[model samples]
Target: MAVLLGPPALAADPAPPSAQGPAFIDWSGPYLGIEGSGGASFGQHTFHGTMIGGRAVPDFKTGDATGRNDRSRNATTAVGGLFGGYNWQTGPWLYGIEADVYGANLKRPVASTAPGLGYEGLDPEFSVLRAKTDLYGTLRGRVGVAFDRALVYATFGLAGADVRILATYPDLAGGGVASTRHDLSYLGFTLGAGVQLALTEQLALGIDYRYLDLGGGGRFGLGALPGAAGGPVSTRDASFTSHQMMARLSWHPAGLTPPPETEGTSSPDDRFSLHGQTTFITQGVPGFRAPYTGPASLIGRQVQSTTTATMMLGLKLFEGTELYYNPEFSQGFGLSRTLGVAGFVNGEAQKAGAPYPKLRSNRYFLKQTFGLGGETEDVPDGPNQVATRRAIERVTVVAGKFAIGDYFDANSYAHDPRVDFMNWGLWASGAYDFPANLPGFTQGVMVEYNRPEFALRAAYTQVPKEPSNDVLDPRVFERAGGVVEFEERHVLPVLDQPGKLRLGLFSNVGNTADFRQVVGLTQAGLFADINDAAAATRRPRRKTGFYVNLEQAVSADLGVFARVSANDGRNESLSFTDIDRSVSGGVSLKGTAWERPADTVGIGTSMNGISPSHRAFFANGGVGLLIGDGRLRYAPERALEAYYALSLNKILTVSFNYQLVVNPAYNKDRGPANFLGTRIHADF
Candidate 1:
């Protein structure tokens, strides 16, 4: 809301109207909420491609279950979204206008492409037909009847969705696979109903059901696949319909009765807040030497760009309880399709590529803090955190969808890639295979005990069922990831400036393969699959690691940071990169002496290494999440990164970055490569 109301100031909340027990439900007000949803999308997926030098088959339909093009397509997804509206109440009748949007997980995983699956398994080099709804939203009108504190309502609206369909076929003429992807926009109608109960005049809990019909429409061209110039070009379309069940916790900024209060310090009764940011990055690499390449090898010469925009919305449910949602739009690809290097550049890029800008909810979480009698600190208002007076020593619990890195292994000088170091190894611990989906976020619970000098935190999150899969394991508590960290704040003995040290340990149990075993299996000829043998031997296993992150400020404008992390490289990488061990450090300096206090310069370097088994896997032609050179003259991957960011304004910054990567992919045979990039960021 700074956009309209001006930059936020520490405005104290007025005492709420005295509680009246919701005797007469007041539904007239401005409201907003974050909701979680689960549902099935049953629709029709149509191929609209033209094949050349191939059979002139009608539609060229495949994988329709019924072996027909007219049959419905089915998929399931867990979703999160945000909605807000203004309501008018006429006695017991209530009416309002609302809008909402959701991001979906609708990818089909290719578990074993290891020369296995009877010659029909999904392969890494090629793909069968698959479709995903990246984003969808609605503009609706709502009408409901209220009785006491309960309200029953129905909603109908206009809806739109973005769908992407992709597949690949063998290009016999070109002797390569022809990859094609089509993105579609569908517009239709939606109708939904729900029941809500007001816990207090300002708070409500509700369950909603929606039926959305994204009308079958439009066709998109795939253009010829990059490697298959003379191959068939393709087009596709999808008609979507979904049944969604959603649970919402809403806050009415205008309330007839005040909410009940309990112990602990509270912020201004301001019910909701908003913050936003946008970042654009473009990078390119020049020519380097390479006699051969593998599935995950990076191209010697290539250029690519990525863009992201996000809006953070937060709501205060009551004292000590708050909810926040982050809706994001992302587009473009990482260099070499985000492969080849353990410390791949561009943390802004998601593992899942988006050919076009797609909107989605990346984070939506609820936080409840329990305070013990202690000193208070003034917490500034930022994206997800609201300005408030909070206990210095308290217990805080957060549950929902969020990035594990957002809460763990934090270093003021090197943690944020968007604003600081861009190398994965420089920005993160590099060895902790933290749980995350395609977008670098996972659902979980995090508990933290905070004090003035020290803090301790623990987290448990859903893990991916398979390495690099978009879908999460259903067994949240059983097959999941857990992390615990101890953070200490101190002052340098001589400098007396502030410094912090964070020690973290992480463990996860998931369906994974040990690198040693996968190599042994292929060597013994049991699976006879040298390609991703880990895929064939994947079973429930545990992987653990620890990290030490330290940040110290020598002067008011100068700070230094370092991280040391490692994991037992026996198992194949579950999430993040292929590095089993990593050490990274950096220094950051403000341009205050130069009269540009907001400007900054950062220089950092990292050495990333993999275990013996991991090296053997690559030597055996096994592909990994990011690095696999097909050949091995094993050495640690080393990189040095430096950047200078200039502040254009309070909310805008432009940065120039350069990175030198030696032994790319840990292969001593490949020479050092250089990466150059620029980033533009704005936040308010």
Candidate 2:
């Protein structure tokens, strides 16, 4: 995905005028919207010529060993974007100009489509070709007619896109793979039509169709493949066209006012709460030293970006009961698709990434609180939380799909990646191996007891079916993860500063193979493959760990935090990253000393180690959840992160960050990488 995209600009406009005719919908004013799109492509694809080891073949038919052509295959996928425009309406007629950019994954694959000439035995070879477009944008003019609360419109626009072509095939002569890649900028045009229905004075819903014609002309150098030498120097061209359908919702800035400044500090009466937020983060790494590479080693250079937008809805069902649901849209990829580094540089990156935005219900849970009859304290209004007074000593129960991190291992100075830290080692316990799906979310039941001096939390949740896998197990009790944590709060004698200490014990029960077991079995010939050992050993197994988290406030404007975690290294990591033991700590400073009270600065560092068997496993060519250098030089992986945040306004903040990773994935031969990143976040 493009790394330059940031969050859309937001502004408030006066409510649409009702003077036009109180009852007639006025389709004029500046409006912003979010859309979900899905579409397909229909275009002609072909191969013009071929050459094998300097020998030219003027005419060759494209086909594979199967005697079939899947090239020019139909392309279908989903897309997401944001749009804004200003409209002017006169009676039932309206005109406007709009601009929008989308996250997209449009690619077609061609395989075994070239022929090897003049090579007797190496005939019927194989090669692969991929045409990819990650992102595109449009600027269009719109004309529409309004009939009461409904509007019909047509749009025409200029479009531009990022295009890439990749081809890979076997090198028959050298017994290796030969590849070629071409990246370019494409300019095209779009035509579309749509209808909108006004749902309220400041809200509307619409659906539209677009035909995008991104004409293309590019050629690739083909390689020699095994069914004989497929080709040493072959070339092919490209064509691009797509039909897209989109659904959108528009909102006026005045539709939802932000919470007051004192919302979280003072008590307020509240039965319902609605809030929304979005964050965009982009990262890049410059060139570095790497004498060699493997399946899981971080490349020397790369840039990537990700975007997420979420809406929170909370309602009080009764006195001590509430329900909350969070819906979200996420797009883009992590560095190297979230591989190579043990403590990855981007905490927000997901292992399962999509070329376009994907929408899903992130959290849906029911919470009930039981008072134990003590002094009461006011809880703030925010995402998934309602403003209310709760007993200082109480018991709370939550059930449904959620993340276990919501209730445990919290450090005021370093917990949330969105606000404080961007490194996984800093924001979470790298060795905890907490249960989760690809996006780090799981289904579970959690209970907590809170008192003025201390708190105890516990939960049982579903885990991924296998290491490096995205799907969570459906049988909760049969394959589950559980944890218990205890936290103590105290005040320092002279500074009178507040501080907390937490200790957590966790365990996972699944069918994961022990590192030693797999290696030993493969050596003894009992197992056919070391990588497939987990399937052979199907009995239940347990992995356990413990962690200590500490956070203290040196003053109202400064805080320091530290964490130490360890887990048994015999079994594979059930979730989380690829570390078996870790220690991390840091200090945070607010700019009050410099008269910029809204700014913050922080520095943190971590060292991650693996168990002997885990190290041996990797040295033997076995791969883990986040690491595997094919071979290992065996060293503890170390990471350092530093960041600064500037509050631009009440609704937005911008942050800059830098990281140093030494011996990534515990391999000493490969790196000492430097990564730089920027984050833009908005909340209400």
State the lDDT of candidate 1 residue by residue for 171-261, as single tens digits.
5455666666777788999887766655444666565667788767544445553332343433334456765555577888887442222
* Tens digit of per-residue lDDT, candidate 2, span 1-684: 011122212122333354223323567778899986433222223333333345443333434323222245445556788988888778778899999888777766644434444333433444456667788799999998764445668899998878776666555556776777767677889887666655444666565556678775555554443435443554444556666556677886544222112214324479887776666677888877777777777886777667666779999898889999998766666787778899998888872265545677889999999999969877888778888888989999999878778888988889888888988899998899999888878889999999989999999998888875678888887899999999999999988999999999999987687888877877788866566665576456799999999999999999999999999988888788888999999999998877667778999999999999998778867777777777898999999999998765445567999999999988889789999988766665
Q: Per-prediction TM-score, please? A: 0.66, 0.73
Error of 2 at 472 (Å): 2.2
Minimum summed lDDT over a 10-residue window in model 1 is located at: 109-118
lDDT, model 2, position 448: 95
Off by over 4 Å in 1: 1-269
Clash numbers, per candidate: 0, 5
